[model samples]
Target: MEIRARGARRPYRSYRTLIAAACAALLGVLLTPAGAQGAPRGPHGAVKVSQPVYSYADSVRESVWVDTGLDGDADGVSDRVVADIIRPAEPARQGRKIPVIMDASPYYSCCGRGNESQRKTYDADGTPLSFPLHYDNYFVPRGYAFVAVDLAGTSRSDGCADVGGPSDVRSAKAVVDWLNGRGRAYTTRTGTTRVQAGWTNGRTGMIGKSYDGTIANGVAATGVRGLETIVPISAISSWYDYYFQQGAPLQGSGPDWLANYVESPAARARCQVVQRRLVDEAPRTGDVTALWEARDYVKNAGRVTASVFAVHGTQDLNVRTKHLGQWWDALADAGVERKIWLSQTGHVDPFDFRRAEWVDALHRWFDHYLLGYDNGIERAPMADIERAPGQWSTDRVWPPRGTDTTTLRPAQGPVAGVGTLGRTAARPGTTATFTDDPRLDEEDWAETADLNTPDKSGFVTRPLSHDLRLSGSSTVTVTATPSTETAHLSAVLVDLGPDTIRDYNAPGEGITTLTERTCWGPSTPTDSSCYRETAPRTADVTHTVLSRGWADLGTYASASHGRPLTPGTRYTLTIDLAATDHVVPAGHRLALIVAGTDRGLIQPPSTTPTLTLDLARTSAHLPLVGGARAFTRATTGAAPTDPAAGRSRPDGVAEPRRTPPIPGESG
Candidate 1:
């Protein structure tokens, strides 16, 4: 094995090969049986056996408080995180030490996990009476302990919630430490009665969605000893990326609001200073400061010892695709054993996308990593991507292989300064300019089809002669200068097809509410593992936004500091569009839109700033399926425009389309 120092970058071409090899070696070492003597279904195939080793109907439900050392609220006492666990009864009597499945989140007592918003329930004695979600009811029967922990300062825990800061991560890390017998836990916040994880085998796996999943990502990056695997669904690998894209602020007053929102009212009051700190620490300039650096898991990817199974929707505008895509790339560089599921839904769980398939895959994933089961999951394909809505395909790796890095430059004469995209670049002196219009929404930027607006510049490619698939993030490099010292730059990739597609940003995104309900597992009176079904909502399509990117022109040179550009003193800025999987069919035009601002996700600037682009050096590089040679050669004799092509809509605006809901997801 290669023994390079941590954080050293490996050759990009060889890292993927090393990841495969390293996973094989790590599997045998990490998956060794804890204790497997005289059992019928020994450690080899523990998960494959028919009968469950433990009983789900009768399990021990309890809570413990773990010490996190720091009192973030500045109280007199140290912080304590609350952990609610459901485990097999009398594990010591059976001489069995079960593995643990934990979900550490801040939403337990407030807005619960999953679509149903199910929260935890407690008895008069303050002990947990029931756990939320199907995790405990499903996994506990299969010999795994399910733990739901309320991060410090949230729910019933002590201390102030610092959002995704060090306190947040340290709180979760302490729970893993306690499970592995390296940390302390008590029956109550300040109780003398101590508790130990004698029922566990010291192997734990974390799983959750959104904030819960973000905890898993943060804790796993600490390289906690007992954490064997993690399943982060639409999780944030970096809080900075969650709030900012490139150097552009995605929203205003996010950090302070989020910090207070997740904490209890009493904790929020006590931590008012901390809330103020959050606001004070936030950089209004959108630069990556030390605060953001501390929350970034990408820099600490090398420390991740646990295997990862990541899930995210490419069209998720909330958490966004970059959160998972960038983190997935980092894990690859770290040579960790990892798998990914890329869907088309917006911020929805895989359970809602493909329930049966999701459960089966998740079951095998835990069995192999948490339990010592040799289920052949390691040899399976690394990625399961939704090519289109509801259409799934498996590949050896993400973005697939054999993609061509195609460069398409802006050519003039299509519509004044707004031009068409082609193989050749426009002459050096030619330029396109636009002023930032905070009033315009994404729909407005998209609907300006006739190039009648001076607020944005648009470029398009003639109807394609054949299908072209974009499988990864596209880079937009432009040579330009802002009219002011500070300005925001927005770039968008578009599909000018005359077909309707899923509108992920819409409410429910086409999912209709149904009266009927479906159950996932056997349930007790306290908890029902079931939900209602939903269907898709549909609309007509004219043009679709594929991927987008943003940047603050002042911070174009560095993220730590901004360098004001002297007006017309050109600076080259390369912005990375979000990663995506899109197919532009035959006779559909591909477009690149350059604008000064995007109001849909960002706050409006106080003043308008104009941007001038030197079209000669400007180009958009896309990772096309057929590569440049194959695509360019294939279209050598093909005409740019097709006679059978459909015309624009009556209002020149393509109506928003909603995606029909597919079966298998619960409402």
Candidate 2:
């Protein structure tokens, strides 16, 4: 492509300039005019980011890269470049010393780089994942300037990636120095802040999700001086516990992900180092202590000098959801300002959020901490929304000091609707079960294991006749018996639809999908609760969310709240099935499905533990919203022929019944 600057006499000369300019063009979308705050969608109904540039100062253009010897990534970009400065944007606010927010993330390969493109086609409808952001951008905009830096040896930078090791730690620090440096350096005809803050006012912070988040936490542990505040969302604290040994062989995600995004020298050379060893070695169960200790974030959590606002989805199988407790404790012990937000959200995405909001929040945080701007971040809630019973709440701490854990039970048979091969329950006398490998052919190894399905039979309280907002963490415990190696369980709290419920986001696209459907993927945590550890385990999988926290800055309690289940209206709490979303209304069954293997879903850990399940004493402990009763009758989102049968849930008392686990033999 012939390249030219916005104002130039000739085409741009350097590829560095070209790439930086393109990134400036792309990442600069945060500059869009302030009036339209909601997510902008294209004609196809996907997120649309508008570009709005304020000033073009050419004097600040300069390149800041230090060559780190071990170049695992051979791309023209240096290892130090990848690890240090992937996409460094200049301070937007003149001499005010705006806070610098830098984050590193694993990029999906666009052209043979091990990076996996969840959003391959720019089209919203066709993309496997949505949005233009790497990972930090998904929610960073609520209050921060998100700088997505590729770790060493990954993309267009240099050196081999250390996957959160010391090399990565030092490189991350180098980038931090570059961000705060107010010193002078080379300038380009093109107005891009490639160099010099040049010396910063010591207002620097690191934030990121997943892999990026892992590094953010690691660097924080090193007691990096320049590193200030951090928001490590869905971080991989205990790598082995969360990545591999959690309960599966090959830990489907880490392997498939490395295969798709971090596989080799060319891939490594193209950017930074390939994660050759991190994802290469197969995880050996019962022997994961070595790996876990190696990746132990808690080891350094206490040493981290920077204050942190940590958030984790209860259902994040990819990361140890329990890390929140440890990280929080470490921060507290270190006397570092600390905060926590846990939710029934998943490794998927936190609802009640828009990209811009996330960006805005991170900005406010950096401004307040890094640049010393009193952005009011500290005044906001310290902890909030592990799950709202129809409305959102803000607290000073996680699991808030005075909060109580309530229980909601399953009162009906687990299965009723779709019985496999004509059987409703796996009766004691019959062999009833579904094989996972047979269904593996249809699974998406990338995200399925972290989020899979075990045939579940359950029900929700009757839907409310009126709309009720429910936002918070949720966990469902099932005493299931599996003849096979394991029993995978998935839970979803669907808004019994047909009632007008509105949130933001477009349809079909990745991020949009969460907002598009009245139904949500299992936004619960997969922990000791979600997964019972007894030989014939009775695991309780809990997932939760805290929308209001420093990590997630400008949040209104209302962001996650949606209409609650209508009174007396029937709603179904589905357990196992393909990923699907739609409205289940009042007067209809709040359907809950339980099964063995689901299409396109990787099964949970398969360690043979055949056992019987008990029901009478079992129930989901949830914060039921007051003023709303169990749905008396529920409406199904099925198309009807009759004109009078309106698609609306009927209101009444909510009552959910749980049936005995179909006692069946392993066929």
Candidate 3:
């Protein structure tokens, strides 16, 4: 094994050959238990497994092609399929046929394919965009053909890329057939025609992000034998739960815009111009259309045959953390031996050097499965990523699979105080109460959200005397009922007192800060201007919380499971603390704000789907181990000061304002 320090870049042409040679000498073909690898069928019915040919900065030509129909009698078919094949751009030292690696670009043409990313997405270095873009690039040089196809109707492909995974599976198969079929001579690299490898042992795999990552689930569902392993980054396990939780869209209009971009008419039209569209576009408005529903990998997640190394970001606003929950459940039930990692990184990490870390991991993954080289990846933690204060940790399984479950009940105390953890008194039935009229004011936004102060919550403050690491997405199941048919809920975790909250909020004023409360000073109890943010989140915030916009669930009246907290009656409200990793200085206390609204990120409730917290049926679930790591808030050993200036939201002089109730609510 070559030992190199961090950030060291060496030419791989020679190193790859060396690694291959070393691998060949040490391990021929490791023995495996029967059925564990399933029945193997190679190219043309014979199994032939050979070492992969890795590429180190080789000549690569980016071209587009039109795929003619292979089967004509299938009701309807796409005109042409577009593909992006990366072979050894120039001649290689080894004589090998193209071992094509085909990947599906799920929803490649969303919104409007017409104006895809501009500039052909070339980097400043003038090199065409490359893969290993997010994960590790170290492995690609090891003799693997990388093919990213734009399916039938998306991008440069021929037909359509429906929003569904089934269509995506078909799109993938089409490319797989093309690469190994008669077209082998068409895709040439250097001086030799490229052919599929792994046919020796039938080991082929795919790696991708977001929509692309989802194709692994679809392909696996088909029970296809050619697939070997998959690396699903920021993957969505179940579209239903991803887009909607508890029947209502957990996310708001944010993702709809993105989905439209993936399958929009404009992108479709552009495919016509470039002949890049893939599968035929599915008819919209049909409840039965595969795209409309059933995108959830969770439903059939148990059937996946491919070994998938699932990685996701704790702060991934696009796909969120729940994807991990659902996918893990499916894989576990199916008894699939898998590794899960939760990252603090953003979605799929397509751009920037931050993605470089994934390279180290990918090299290890491919080396183990594709080349049969064990590089110690199997012994790595199931969940691994940077932890609080820039440190990192790993667990055997997600949620550690063995961490003790603890209940954190909210009780009464000053929102800000030189306080204690949990609650002051630990009685069996502990509770905290605060009065929230239909009106209150929020002048600050939580940095926790991808949107400016996306979290919908309210807070009161006390001082924090010590720093704390508040990490991991949490669950708060409180029995709450609104006298009115509908209301919204916003829960926040804040650092209160002099230094903590001030220190945390000051970041909002960063040179030119965002969000309403910080941008615009806090307003009157009834003023909505202070609540609106320049960049709002996706959830509907209108009625219950004084959000920038409104989403009404309607007052369904009673929550069948819980009692209604009479407008004047004593009732319990629950708050889900946004995960954080900040240091609270000696003079500050972490403030946990439980409120009804914070525009953008979240808001109260509406009818048709009013919320009810069952006090009798309440609990809070926090995955304490190996999740999002809290930060070192007091690393500087100093307190934070107030913002020099604050920005406010646009105020309509004529709009009526609502006021939050003071601590007193009259019966």
Ranking by TM-score: 1, 3, 2
Instruction: Compose the digit string of candidate 1's lDDT tens values, residues 459-576.
Output: 8876666666787778898778677766778888887867655456565443343555555544566666565444444456788788888877776678656666677678888887
Residue-level lDDT of model 2, residues 204-240, one tens digit each, is: 6777666667778877887767788888886766554
CA lDDT of 227 in candidate 1? 96
Estimate every model's Cα lDDT from 0 to 1: 0.73, 0.38, 0.39
| Candidate 3 CA-lDDT value | 0.39
Q: Which residues of candidate 1, in runs, are more than 4 Å off?
A: 1-53, 414-418, 449-452, 633-667
